[model samples]
Target: MPQLITAPGEAVVNRYRTSVVTPRVDAQVVKRHVQLGDHVDAGQALVTLSSVAMATAQGALLEADTELRRVKQLGRDVVSEKRFVTAQVAYQQARAQVGAYGMSDRQIDALIRQGDAARADGRFQLLAPQAGTVINDPFVIGQIVAPGYELLRITDESRIWVEARLPVNEAEWIMKDVAAIVTVGDTQLNGKVVQLHHQLDDTTRTRAVHIEVANPDHRLHPGQFVNVVIEGKAQQAQQGIVVPKAAVMRSKDGDWQVFVETAPGRFEAKEVALLRTAGERVMIDGIAPGTTVVARGAFFVQSEIAKGGFEIHNH
Candidate 1:
C-alpha cells in the first residue's frame, strides 16, 4: 500500500473557469441585465452601456458604407484604382472600430440593415462570454466606467481547486496526478493532485500542492479550510506484510504488536515494527507471510490475554 501524507489545504476559485467582464472603450452603464449571484448563460445579455466613441465609430461606418456603394456603382474608368481601394479600406476599418467598441457582428449587421445614420444611438450590450454564475457585479446604472475597468466577474463553481501545503520532505514523495482525499469536517471528497510547486515557502519551508476537486452540488466554497490526505508513492519496494491498522496495538511497554493465532481459538501478542501507513492499512515487519494473524478483533484478543495475566511483551 502507498503511504499517505496529510496536509492543510484551502479551497479556491479555479481561475481557468473564471471570466472578467470589462469594456474596451469608456462607457456609461445604462442598465444591468443580471445581478450578483445570478446564474447566466453564454451569449446572455449582461449589461448595457452607452459610449460617445461608439456613436462616432458607427457614424463613420455608415458614411464609409455609402461612399463604398457609390464608388462601386461608378465604372472603373470613372473612379481611380486608389479611390476604390481607399473606400474599401475605410469601410473595413470603420467596421472593425465599431466591433472593438463592443458591437457584436450581428448587431453591426442590424445597424447596416437600418442604414440610417441618425439611428446610431451608441448603445450596446455586454454579453456573458460563457455560462457561469455572476459572482461579482460592482457597477451601477448611470455610472461612468473607464476602459479596462473590471465591471463584473463570472465563475463556474462546478469544479474548484484546493491548495494544500505539505512539508518539503513529504511533498517530495508525491507527484502530479496522485490521488488525494480532502476532508471538510466529517465529509470526505476525492481529489487529484494537479500541480506541485518546486519553490518552498520562505516562512514555512513547505511546498504548495494544488488538488482539483469536483463540486457538482456547489457545496464547496472558496476560502474554506480543509484537510487533505495525499497518497504518496512508496519510497522503496514493499517487503513487509500489510495488515489492517486495527490489527496493530501498542503493548504495555509501548511497543507496536499484533495478535497472532497460535492454536485453535488461542492467540498470542507478537511485537511488530511499523513501516508505513496508507490510510487504514499499515505495513509492518517482525511478521512472516502465511502467518495466521488476527486481522480483525485483535483488540478483543489482547483484552482477553490481559485478563489471564499473560506476558504481552516479546523478548
Candidate 2:
C-alpha cells in the first residue's frame, strides 16, 4: 500500500564543545595564527610563545650535554669512576625534564653535545591536537600565555548533534524517519531522527532527543538555534470510499449519507454504510468507485448536501 505522509520535523546540527588556551606561561604569547572560523588540521600551529622558561630549559639541556661528553671521555675508565658517574647522572636528569614536555629525542641529542642550554624558554608554538573549525580564538598579537591558559577553542564540525525537547504529551510515535527541517536563521537543513531520549525534563515536563545529520556539505553549524516539527501518523484501514468526518451525516433516524463531488462545484447525495472513522478520514462501504468524496473544508459542502437543516454540536 502507498504510504501516507509519515512524521515530519525541522532540525539542525550541533556539537558538544568548549574553548581552550594554555595557562599563563613566562613566555610571551607572540601571536595566535588560528582565527575564529578557520579550519585547522591536526598538529597545525595555533599560537606562538616566547618565554624565559623555555630558555632556561634549553640552557639546562646544554649543561647536561657538556656533562655527558666529559663522562663519555672517561668511559670504562675505573680510575675516574666517580667523576664519570656524576656527569652521566646530570645529563640523564636534564634530558628527562625536557622530554617530559614533548621535546623531541633529536633535540635532546643535539643539546648533549652543545654547551648551550639545550632548550631556552624562547618563542614557542602550539599545534592543534585535531582537525577542527576554530570557534572562539580571540587572542590578539603579543598576548602573554602560560601552560594552563586557554588560547582558542575549535569545534570538530565534521559530526554534529542536536538536542530536541518534546513534551510528554508527545509520544514515541513522534520518532524515526520524520521529515525534519533544521534551521539556523535563514539557513535550513533536512535530517531524520537518530534517537529519542529516555529521560524526562523535570521543569518543562519534556524529553530531550538527539538527532544526527550529515554535515559533509558543511551547511549546518554547531550550537545554532533550531525548530523541530514532528508530524505523527494517521491511519484508518479497510479501504473503501474515504470521506471527511463532516460529510458523513448522522440523521435523527441514525443513518449516514455523504456528498460525492460529481463536478467541480456540484455534488450528488449518496447513501453510505460507515465502516470506520479515524482522525479526519472515514471509510464508508457501497460508495461508488471513482467517487470524489469531500475530504477537507467540507463543513459547507456537507451543509449544502443536507436536504434539511440538522443540529450539530456547537462546542
Candidate 3:
C-alpha cells in the first residue's frame, strides 16, 4: 500500500442517513407497498402511480402518426407542400408533447405507427436506489404528489461514517492507507482513513476527514461515538551523517549552513545538504562521523562573528 502521509484524527458513526426529495412524475398514488420501519433492498419498488394521462398521450401520438403516414403515402403531386408540412408538424408536435409525460422515444414512435403506445399507467414507479430501512410516512393511496415531492425517506444506518473535523495542518499529511484503531462503545476495530480535504475553513480552521470502517455484522450504526489516531513519522532511516538540530542555522541571506569544528578552538563555516529531520536531530550529507561538528550553540558563534568576536582566518 502507498503511504498516505496522515495526521491525528477521531472516528464517529452516523446512525441516520437520508436521501430525500427526488423527482416523482405522477400526482396521485395508486399503490403503496412500503411503510415505516420496513427494510428495503436496492431497486425495491415502493409505490406506483395511476398513469391516466400517460395512456391518453399514447393514443394522441398514434392518431397523429396515422394521419401523417396516410397523407404522405398519397400521390406526391396530389398533396401541396404546405399541407404536407402542416400534417408533418402536427404529428411531430403531438409526439414531442406526449414524451413529456414520460414515454420513451421508441414507444412514442411505435405507438404512432401502430396507433398503440406501450401502456404508461401514468403512475410512477418508486424504486429504492440504495438498500436501507424505510422511515415511512410516505404516501397513502389517492395522495397527490408534485414533481419534486418526497414520497419516501429511507435511512441506510448499516453503512455509515462519522464525519469528523480535523485540523488543517495535520490533515494535510494524511496517507491513503493510514490505519487506525476505532473505538465503538466498548469495541475496538481496525479502520482505514481516506479522502483528506486539501482545503480548510478559514473561520473554524477545520478540515474534513473521511474515516471508512466496515460494519459487516450490523454492529455499527450511522451515528456513534468513536476515536481516531493519525500516526506519522517525519524521518526515514538510512545511511547518512546526522547532526543535532541546533547545529543547522540560517545565514544573513537565509541560506542553511553549519559550522565544522576542524580542531579545538578552531572552526570553519561549511555548507551541508539536509535530507530529513528526526526529533532534535537532522540527517545531512558532506560531514563525516569523526569530523568534529559544532553540535550546539552554532547560532552564538554566528552572533560572535557578526559582532567581530573572533579573528578571520587568513585566506
Best-fitting candidate, scored by lDDT: 1
TM-score of each: 0.83, 0.57, 0.49
Give the clash count for each candidate: 0, 36, 22
Please identify which of the two predictions, 1 or 2, would achieve the higher TM-score against the true structure.
1
Model 2: which ten-residue window has the lowest total lDDT? 1-10
- Candidate 3 lDDT over 1-315, as tens digits, reads 121233333434433456652443555777778888788887777776655665566566667777788888994798888878988898888777666654546545555555544543354455676787776455678887777777777767654564556676556566665665566657766666656667777888898777666766666654455655543423322557877889998877776788876666667677778776643567788777788777877877777767855543431
lDDT per residue (tens digit) for residues 15-109 in model 1: 88999999999999999999988999989999999999999999999999999999999968999999999999999999999999999998888
**What are the C-alpha RMSDs, in order, of all predicted structures?**
4.0, 8.4, 14.2
In model 1, what lDDT does residue 70 have? 95
For model 3, the superposed segments whose C-alpha errors exceed 4 Å read 1-21, 24-26, 51-121, 135-142, 153-159, 201-203, 233-315
Compared with the true structure, what per-residue lDDT tens digits does model 2 show for residues 1-315? 112222223333344533354634455767778778898887787877777766666677677676677567657654377777777787777777665543446555665445444345454466676677887765677776556666777767665666677766554556566555555557656666666778887897777766666667776665566655444433412456776677787644777877666656666567779876543566788787787765654557566546564333331
Would you list the rank order by lDDT, best first?
A: 1, 3, 2
In candidate 1 the C-alpha lDDT for residue 247 amounts to 92
Please list the C-alpha lDDT of all candidates, in the order they appear: 0.88, 0.62, 0.64
Q: 1 or 2: which has the higher lDDT?
A: 1
